[model samples]
Target chain A: MNLISEPGAGALILRVQEERIDAAVAIQFKDRLRELTAGGEGPVILDLSQVTFVDSSGLGAIVGAMKLLAPSRPLELAAMTPNVARVFRLTRMDSVFRIHATAPETALHVRAAG
Target chain B: MCAPPDDAALMPAMAPADCSALRGGDDCFRRNFRAEPLAVRDALRAAVARFARRMGPDDAGTLELTLAEVLNNVVEHAYAGLGAGPIDLTLCHAGGRLHCRIEDHGHPMPRLAAMGRAMPATDVACTDLAEGGWGWALVRSLTEGLAYRREGDRNLLTFEFRPACR
Candidate 1:
């Protein structure tokens, strides 16, 4: 898993480059998200534009990251591909997170609100 | 078309040869999965859906997903560690159920009990999300029935589901 992190407009944007979020890669996925989201870095934007698949195990890791970053910093989803989006929608988790269509727009919104 | 009650009753008692020959008024297709998994998946999906549609439309998506998940395991685990030989696939529909059987000339079938023992909590967060154990879990959740056996050099996995019941 590769994550390219940058501070944009005020929120931290995390671009994910991976094909799947499954049992084999969930641990690496969580650790990288944690590393990027640590120290209360405002609202974090996760760009899953490239992800093709995510299972329940993968979903749990993302939920765990969100819980860990909660109260201190909020986690937001952005630019989800169809397969990854199907997973979230299937699990009824799409309602739990603020999903934006793009990372920069999410960052700009957060910046304007903050 | 409606069959006579006597014929319907005798259907269950028919000889294995007779049953094998019976089409259940449906068509069948078998394919080899040595060349392309995606193409095999697409073809299998269409075939299974065609069978399911004869019963009803409600289960085509579920059947398609379950078949893909199990065949993916066949492709990923069975062929990865072992050499890739032809994976025999058969699709047949009878008695309101669609049966799919996948046979591979790979190692012995995976022990599901051992896999059950190895499953971590679903809530546990792993940094590496793509590795290990989830394939079997997905298969278990998606299919109504599963059976595995090894005869000689072939590992056979059979899965069955009723589209109408779904």
Candidate 2:
């Protein structure tokens, strides 16, 4: 898994390149998140439009990162793939985070409003 | 492939009685393949996904992933180097639940439950992780129930899912 960063309009965009986000790559995914947040960024917009599938391990890593960030920073997901979206919906994680339909839209929301 | 004489003929006494059995029904489905692990994984995922949709979407992700990992294991280890043998998979959905069975003429039944122990200290990296270990860990977490046994040179793995009622 590769995490590429681009300065979105207001938020940092993370592009995930992988076919599946299962145990095989969950750790790397989490580590990248940690590396970014630890750099003292204000907020992040994850562009998951490229991720095709995610398993429990991947879900756990994401949830763990959210808890690690706590009330300090906000992490948002945008443009979920069908299989990835299914995991979020089935686990009810969709309700826990702000989900946008596209990467540009996610950055726009964070930039335009609060 | 031609439809069987009776859809139920594809699955004999081993099938759960609570559901309608068919060779090609959306509820019950079967496919045979030539012991290729990746192909088996695809077939398993497709069949399990169908079963989950027919059964309901509650925890369907878990069921589908579990079935794929389990059947993949069977394809890889069961017939590792054996000549050629058919791998049979049957899936059924009824009673608000989904069930899948995979049978292969591979080696004897393995100690799957015993191997579900937490990953050892040395297995943190991709190289150290054994082939069969992570797959079983996935199975342990995904299914509502599981059973493994050998029937006359055939290794049979049955997985059941009855997610909490919505």
Candidate 3:
């Protein structure tokens, strides 16, 4: 349940260090994210490159985290493993959140190059 | 003959057990666990990973996702209000398909008939997007021959999956 946080381009990039986020840690995951992002301003980029699996509870936890932000801050996802990404795609949560193929640093680089 | 033989003697005698090495048929695995949310994920992941390995990585991943969803439902709804109970799972591979059977004694299946068994609308605005209902939809979309039954005190759910290439 360790999350590495980095600030990038007016956004907080939080990378999950775990390999799987399922029912076991879904509640704790949401609680930790809420605690970390509390009173924080600007968008949050959740980097899921290390996550290989996410179940319904994990997905709900993510959505719950988004709702916790409400109208003020947005939550974006980045660098999802193929398996993790499939859960989002299959559930169609891909449409709800902005997704990036790489971390914000890489995304920022691409934007600068363009 | 005197007293029509003793009651125990009148009963059929147990047959002698054959002692030999049993040949494995279809691959089968079973596990029983307490209906607790925290333990459900780990148990399911390990079991699904073991069986899915035989199919392939892709199918394994799919199986993990679908099974997780179903097991979570059991933990959330089935065990809700009721105290912790035993959740039994059996996985078998035969006829070129993987069959999963889950049994629990917590609660009966809810009114899924009204749910329409269809994927929810994903085209809605971001604000209107749903988080929860997607579980069953994903399970339905990935697996085939999904069925549910309740017999007396137990609830049984069965589903099957073919290989990814199939």
Taking chain B only, the TM-score of every model is 0.67, 0.66, 0.78
**Worst window of 10 by summed lDDT in candidate 3 chain B:** B1-10
Docking class of 3: incorrect
Residue by residue across A63-90, what tens digits does model 1's lDDT show? 7787777655767787776556655554
Error of 2 at B154 (Å): 1.0
Q: What tens-digit string does per-residue lDDT give for candidate 2 at A6-44?
A: 777667777776666665567788888788768665557
Question: How do the residues B85-108 of candidate 2 rate in per-residue lDDT, one tens digit apiece?
Answer: 788888766655566788889987
Q: Number of clashes in model 2?
A: 0
Residue-by-residue lDDT tens digits, candidate 3, A14-98:
8898998888898889989998898889989898878988987888889888878766888888888778877877776666676
TM-score of 3: 0.83
Alpha-carbon shift of residue B13 in model 2 (angstroms) = 40
Off by over 4 Å in 2: A1-48, A55-114, B1-26, B55-58, B83-85, B110-115, B119-132
Task: Please tell me which model should have the higher lDDT, number 1 or number 3.
Answer: 3
In model 3, pairs of residues that clash are none
| Pairs of residues at least 3 apart in sequence or in different chains that clash in candidate 2 | none
Best by lDDT: 3
Instruction: Report the Cα RMSD per candidate.
Output: 14.0, 13.4, 18.3
Q: DockQ of each candidate's interface versus the true one?
A: 0.04, 0.06, 0.14
List the per-model TM-score of the A chain.
Answer: 0.86, 0.84, 0.89
The interface root-mean-square deviations, each candidate in sequence, come to 18.2, 17.6, 24.9
